[model samples]
Target: MTILYMLLSSLEITDISEQELELIEPLESKFPIDKIKVTVCCQSSFICFRFYVLSSRYKWMTYKEAATARTAIGCGLIHHGILKGSCIALYFINRPEWLIVDHACAVYSLISVPLYDTLGPDAVKYIINHADLKAVFCMPLTLNSLLSILSEIPSLRLIVVVGGMENEVPLLPSSTSVQVVTYSQLLSQGRSNLHPFCQPKPDDVATVCYTSGTTGTPKGVVLTHGNLIANASGFTISVKFNLSDVYISNLPLAHIFERFDHISLAHFGVAVGFYQGDTMKLIDDFADKETPSKGVFCKSNFKHVCRAEYI
Candidate 1:
């Protein structure tokens, strides 16, 4: 009778294999998205791989592609001597390239400092100087704004502009040692010279987010990879997410709230669509009188998911 009782207590309630357990373990790690499913929409710009989600408007990037880009970009940064713990600034609006740069920063253990799109030159100058940024990624328009203060930021040695060729970049001052290149060029260079990913400790700082500077001088909020994972994991407890969810990111990714929002979506293999930097334009694109969609429910679902806890 005692043996029978012991056997009953020892019996496993759930039958999960080691392989399944291994897949689930990443959920607790600082990089949960590394293990999640990879899915891309039919209109994806890249070749079809196993995709976990789909997009209606722009091409969707699968987790696999993101991982590849992360490694490739990390390699490029290494060639430029932007080693781990170096500060890299992202000065673009919410776009696919932003995600690629963010993940690449994580892959190489580089600290990402995001600049607000609406921020004036003075704010940009302060944050870049304060963080001692070594490199910067910006859109062509944002690059124009940075040009005015590029000479002031002595630590900045590299400027990679998105959506523009090198010849198109505005001439820089002779005194500034900054070398300008395009985003694709960097990716191509990196893919040609691949490198191993950096393994960051749980306490390693991931990003330095600055406040809006409404009250005083904008202060930098340093966040560790574990802190971000904790924030994303907390949201997972309240509302469950799956691969089917599509997130429309209208908020500035510079904000900690929006940064965690993307991390949470990545955890669930959810697709994200960036608003075209304009709210009214987004409304027209979604509700265009001529274009038909899968339905309004998909769009409404995005709102529901985004409205969840931000912290």
Candidate 2:
């Protein structure tokens, strides 16, 4: 029983390996110096990782590709162009910057509906029915409260759950009337089928963002890719951000505020320090004690304190 329990508990990945753990166990009379390892507590947990700029694997990309493809697509939702269709409805718990860009460029020309994460099921149902959303591109939802509302959202034709397969959400319904896809699948279709130069243009209507009116029904706001590019670029040039800055992230990506900064950072090749929850919390914990070695706070919590060379 003890062995089984130990094995089960051992699955948690510490950023440090057995080799580093050994060095850590013996209290060295010496101070924590070059490559010193320690744990830091962060927004909802503890995380661990050695401090270094070039050690991580995730790479920063450039701007030229930003206009060609969806700014960011997950593992399953990859198909583009004709497959994406037009006059679609995008339901996001977060801001849909990429969708708007596509809409602006005449790529997807989607109508976006924003769902409030804190609302009860009843409110969600009301918005879906009222919006006449034809297709929804969204991150996976917990408790399937989203799926329950689907039956009531008549205009909904497709559901796109972004990212990979190991997600906790349940398998989408077996019904053929409404289909579910992952983000990568959409990108795959585009990569394999679309003409390399045939991507959405810069001047088209990128997306329709519906405002959540507290007193009345929601109103849709038309936005273009040009708008997002201009907005994101303003931050990029003014913020002095560079390709090497790393930011620790955890904010819902479905808002324009996040998109504004994401475009700036992505264009510059900023290394994003994504936490696997607690495992990545250590980096921030360490950042708190020392001078910020280019600290990036929660998605919304961040702001430009200095331009590119702030660190």
Candidate 3:
């Protein structure tokens, strides 16, 4: 017999236990935990793409800053009449803004739907129409793709470009009634008129992740708040994480695995650094010697894996 079957046979258990099927409490309950003094860790924790800003140095947002931003963004959405349970699309590569918007969704009980680059234009169009998304948060690199498909998605009302200046955005056709705004503009409006948080229950839907459509048409999978919490809790138990640990997030956040990784690591106050949007330079980011901090504590070269070290 195979080693896996042999191991299973050695176990005395016949059926899965009740505890195994039970869901854990939401992580939001532990908001601003005493031990998690700082959420995103250091100033150089979240590095932006070199193309966006000519600086080689990185920047970060502390948990407090992140929480404030998320609250503002959530209020901004509400100000725009995007009520709770409304579906918002996240169409961009991994970045700090992505996480900020995601947290906004969780806090305000809005549903987040991720769009993957690997899904191409056709699949993306399909997913947008299928989900009936009204607003999409994108970056300069992904804006063109989204704009290209705008005429086809009538339900789309607003386009918030993250990390992009107003002038950089291409002029939309006069016929299209869709509005486009910068991320800063949204935050500004939100700060002016804040809205109360519309917290979600554990059974509420958190996200609807679409598949790659490799088989044919892309299919969206619904995930609840309880589902994410349970998965993140299980991950926390499997690995011993330290508060000083830093996780390098290089995987696409559109995928559930990467999403879970972010949630799990952040639960323990682990600092997460996003890749510089260039896979080739990822190694350089890991071995970056010019960081304002001292020498690196450790290194791991695995793909889509977190490298724990002190910076």
Candidate 4:
């Protein structure tokens, strides 16, 4: 079966009427109605894999699982007093957990500051310090480099590791005062002590992305929740991806192009698969017979694959 067929047939999702789908604001009004579907996608026996994290395969998450994770991360943030409008850094690559934390941030109405995983220590330090980030949801790849400049970023207090355990926490400088917590632990705390979801205003800043600092200091670009919704809505109407569409998300989420597409695809409830890091293996993933019609590939790789008809 095709990836789109697998998603629609196996999962139970309420179809958003055309009227409701056209609504400009994603989270509308003072008391937001829960019309937005959290039950986007889930694991089924049909699909081979949902997320290829490096070489490992992770099954898809159901709506309930996604909601639970949302509550868990939101509650964990709240418990630590990371309230609405607070700035936090999402320093990781393209992974399933990245999207979970993103949804959780939206739940709490917290501002997200996305950092490239491959950023240099100076760039990392500059962004953290400039944003005055107090918390960060990161992975080992970025965390290791971040730790080197942790002392310089005094505003940062919490390091929520997305994939690693507390035991695996690296040693910090004696002067650095930062608390490390595992992602699962945060989810546990959130699950037990669920907090009320905060409604975000259209103008509320959803994320702050930094530009590549080729010349000097990186420039920060602020995008509001409304901006994101508008872009996603536009993309949906323009691209029109359906349930049967299977998409491969392999580009860096830190970039606006990739990030916007991911958010847009989620709104459409299309199945998205994350690519494993190796470009050599990427051909194998897309070349598979079951690979669907739709996929977002990197611009850099476009030239090489332009001759291939499957793309």
Candidate 5:
């Protein structure tokens, strides 16, 4: 029976070797026959683990579970499923079109909406005021935009943004009644026991994205874990895979494309570096050898050095 389960588990996963698959198929077959027939679909949510937590020092931050150890994020994603060590991952692109098709293949529950990039404060306020938004996970810029109008919408309860900063921003009259947290901090705060990284469940509505409307009012799209996982798996298959490198994530993570590929790539053993806001200023230094530039200031005593003729 032990050998049978091993053989069965291998067959359920498509990426394994034929011999390995053959050896493990029977073992896995013992599982619910219905489960056996069910294909293991990686949805956008399952494809990547994008949320992060800041370290104790808070100078730098990584995924909620990363602690000091960096990872190839995709590798981390499938670590339970396949790989041995935790991997680092990063996200930059944010395209729902790419996320939708793949999302369909994995979990099949997709009610996704694109949070509008161009919507005004009024529109954002309206969405938060009316929509039954359970939670909001966003990047730094979007978070800022939302904060501006939070007072306008009293219905909003929680805001979960992605990155960390030296100081927490002042929300709701400099310091009123608005809960603010980064993705990493939220996980850390929410953890009940030793396990630091626990994502929201599959059935929970994952996101409430408001599309950027050019003509009509922006509409919110609701997404689930299944939808996200499907997007993630399809994205993993398209990239040129190699786990030893780092990916630059400049695009808005709120978009599924960045979130999916970033998480999927991590499973493949790639590390991700998230340069703040605009990536253009970052020195094009991905090579392991490039020394990070240290901030420096120069000061010289002008009169003493020049021997000023006074007197």
Candidate 6:
């Protein structure tokens, strides 16, 4: 059967065998699937997101905690009627909750479709309608933009707001049929009603990333679990990463480059830090006086760097 399957493909690699292909697994292969707490037994925090309102502060989560959150969020998604294999949209800036929700989708075999704010409302509406997203996990800033187009997205049933709602939930149109819930509320519901994990095959679609629409209407690029793992593997071969290394996630998560970077870095158990939403303060974040630096910076197209003292 494997020989026949390989022969049917357009390209053939005589050196590679069917057994090698079968060995390919999802991101969980590097990370673990079961015993989430024990597998990522790192006591130190693995992910942190900064908040700068009046002062600078960071919210940290250990790998164990992140794994737990992902599981709960995945179960919560199921409880909210977002079945496995459904397409969910992630509309937000770079943040910890974004990764949490994305990891949840990965664990449950749901296809995550990322929506960038720079894409504008028209493009966002087009992608939402085009992908037929079942649900959207967005921050409070992007909530209004999504709500404005609620009438257009027929497939969207749930709106899981990441941050707590600062103001009262906006009154929805009488004709709309969407339910809004806070991130914490969803987590609580999921905790009470835990669902079994639905593992995905290598060939299963992991995400459907959209083009920037600079030339024309955005087009969705379907990527499978195998494709992602392969991309990460290739990246690691080119760039070495260490478990003690820290990665600052200032790039937009919606971009495929940044997405692949995150996957590869996480595979190496590298800690990740998210900058405050404001781009103007990005330099300030790098020059944080409270945190010491090792004076080593890796220059990249995206300016990937980390403060060694953060770890």
Provide TM-scores for the models: 0.75, 0.51, 0.76, 0.76, 0.46, 0.78
Top candidate on TM-score is 6
Tens digit per residue, CA lDDT, model 5, 196-281: 22222445454455555555676666665545545554554555544334455555555555656554543443434443333453
Q: What tens digits encode model 4's per-residue C-alpha lDDT throughout 1-311?
A: 11111122224435533432222132222322222232344431112222333433334354435545665787798888788888988887766667677777776788878888777888989998899998998886667776777768889888998778678987665666787788988888776776666667667788898987877899999998767766655555557655556666667788888888766566556555666665677776666564434322221211111101221
Cα lDDT tens digits for candidate 3, 1-311: 11111111122233433332121123323332222222323222322222213444333355545556776898888888888888999987766678878888887788899988566888888888999888999877778888888889988888899877878877777899777888999999887777666656667788999887889999999998777766765666667666556777777899999998877765555567665556787777767554432111111121122233433
Q: Write the per-residue lDDT of candidate 2 for residues 70-174, one digit (tens) a residue.
A: 422311122432233244434443332333232222322333344544555665566666655555555565336667767677666666554324354466657
Model 6: runs farther than 4 Å from truth?
1-40, 49-59, 171-175, 277-281, 292-311
Rank candidates, TM-score, best first: 6, 3, 4, 1, 2, 5
Candidate 6 per-residue lDDT, tens place, 175-211, comes to 7789888898889988788765676666888899998
In model 2, what is the error at residue 111, expressed in angstroms?
Answer: 5.8
Report the poorest 10 consecutive residues by lDDT, candidate 3.
1-10
The whole-model lDDT of each prediction reads: 0.63, 0.40, 0.66, 0.63, 0.36, 0.67
Q: Mind giving the per-residue lDDT tens digits that candidate 1 earns over 1-311?
A: 11111111222224433432222212123433332222333222221111115544423344455556666677787778789899998887776677778878875678989887777788888998999999999878788777878768889888898777778976676777987888888888887876655656658888999987777677999998767766665677786665455566778999988998777666555556554456766664445443321111123122211111111
Q: For candidate 5, what is the total of clashing residue pairs?
A: 46
Q: In terms of TM-score, how similar is model 3 to the real structure?
A: 0.76
Over 4 Å off in model 4, which ranges? Answer: 1-58, 170-177, 288-311
Tell me, by lDDT, which candidate is best: 6
What is the number of backbone collisions in each predicted candidate, taken in the order shown? 5, 33, 0, 1, 46, 0
Query: How well does model 6 score by local distance difference test?
Result: 0.67
- Report model 4's TM-score to 2 decimal places: 0.76
